[model samples]
Target: MLPFVEYAAKGEHTASIIWLHGLGDSGEGFLPIAQELKLPDDLGVRFIFPHAPEQAVTINGGMVMRAWYDIKSLDLDNRADESGVKASAKAVEALIQAELDKGIAGERIILAGFSQGGVIALHLAPRLAFKVGGVMALSTYMCAPQKLVDEAVQPDLNIFMAHGSHDPVVSMSAGQLARDTLQHQGYQVSWQDYPMEHQVCYEELVAIREWLMATLS
Candidate 1:
């Protein structure tokens, strides 16, 4: 199993947020954001940051690195790494179950991530047997759109999606597509766009903080 780092609020906040990072990043990369966001202090939420297993990313031409999945090619039309997606999905599911065992109910847990990690969160959030509090996908998209409709276990899950208008890595269209697909499937989605590119901005953080408070309150 991949290693994971954890951050817990000082208070007894039952709610939890699983923070997943993008490719090439370790779990530590996003743990500090929990502090910067003042999430624990504000909402009494715990955080879980899980590291993706280190492997070669095909999209990067088999470069040995940490990736949630293989990006088979630069050709945007090429196939995705299905095997990596499955493995990461199972890992994420396991993490959710572990949190449950620690007394966090499924509905009090939020699946959140950025980029590749966001892809995983969106992929797994709807499939969990129990409904989650919400999902936050930042600059990401659905990995397997076709499988979602059939596999999703919860159609009413709340989702917050944000994308940079000038994003050069993951196109804004990807985020739009995700929003469309989820709404078509009957999910409640809150979508936002920022004026930046491929990264989170201060305004985006403020919006996320407000969403978290509203959803978890």
Candidate 2:
């Protein structure tokens, strides 16, 4: 199993959020964000943050880092390492199964990620055997939209995608394109944008918090 950190629910674990970090980051990367969320104690939502496996990233000059996939180029379409991505998807699938093994219903679990992590979340969420609670993608682009329709058991699974207006790393256009693609292909998606660049902001966090409440309520 991939290494992970957990934030226990106030009482029993009635729901869970398996969150992934951006490239070169680990499980601890998003712990502060989860803490800052300070979800109501009654929600009984456990948060699981998983560390991406370390691999050589091509865009980073083959420097080894904790990345969901190796980025081959800056181009959104050609950048993804498909093989590595599928592998990590399998790893994440195991995490989901682990949650199920512990008794959380598939619909009570969510998949969220930032940047490269978001790419994987969008990739695997729809294809799972059970319809997951939701998908949250931040500052990331979608991959292989062509395959999603054919593979998805629940094409309309709720999705929340947010991006920065001035993001140089992933580009706002990429996020917009992803939202359009998902919407056009019949997915329920909520879109948001901010004035920042390639990072989360307070406003985005507020929206996310609200989304979480609505999802778990």
Candidate 3:
């Protein structure tokens, strides 16, 4: 089971958002973003933030860390965490199901994340059995670009990806690659680049709010 930090809007549940956070951070880390979005007062959108399991990070040389999966190496040039990819995918699947149990339909829900969380959102959004409202990936990249076409388990789902040009952690190329891959697969994609680092900017937040209002309204 996955541990989660939840924020429910006032009134009945009309929609829901499942947010995932990056590595080394807890689910609570992204709660402030949810609050900032100020989901429509009457829309009743619930935000769910799930914390990844704690385990030794191979990418960090087996250092005990709170990671979605294990990284085999830290070399940015050769960084691909296979274990982390699979584990996080499974956790996302479970979270989706949990939301379903709460009566939220797939298309009424949104999956979003930042950095590492963004990676998971991109990886799993396409594989969900039911179509989701949309996906928002901030300052992140797809873990394995090559497998996206084959492993995807759902139909076309709108995707919004934003990355900082000066991101020192996950290169801007990663986000570009994800956009190219998804577009090549005929998926609806909205890609944006900012003049910042490995973090979200106010402009990006504004773009996100606009996208959410347009897509989920």
**Candidate number of the best TM-score:** 2
For candidate 2, the TM-score is 0.97
- Candidate 3 Cα misplacement greater than 4 A, ranges: 74-78
Q: For candidate 2, lDDT tens digit of each residue in 146-203?
A: 6766767775689999999999999999889888878877889999999999899999
TM-score per candidate:
0.94, 0.97, 0.94
Instruction: Give stretches of model 2 more than 4 Å off.
Output: none
lDDT of 3 at 122: 87
Clashes of 2: 0
Worst-scoring 10-residue span by lDDT in model 3: 71-80
lDDT of 1 at 54: 87
Give per-residue CA lDDT, model 3, range 19-100, as digits (tens).
8888788888888988887668777788999888888876676788677766575454346576667778887888888878
Clashes of each: 0, 0, 3
In model 1, the clashing pairs are none
lDDT of model 3 at position 90: 86
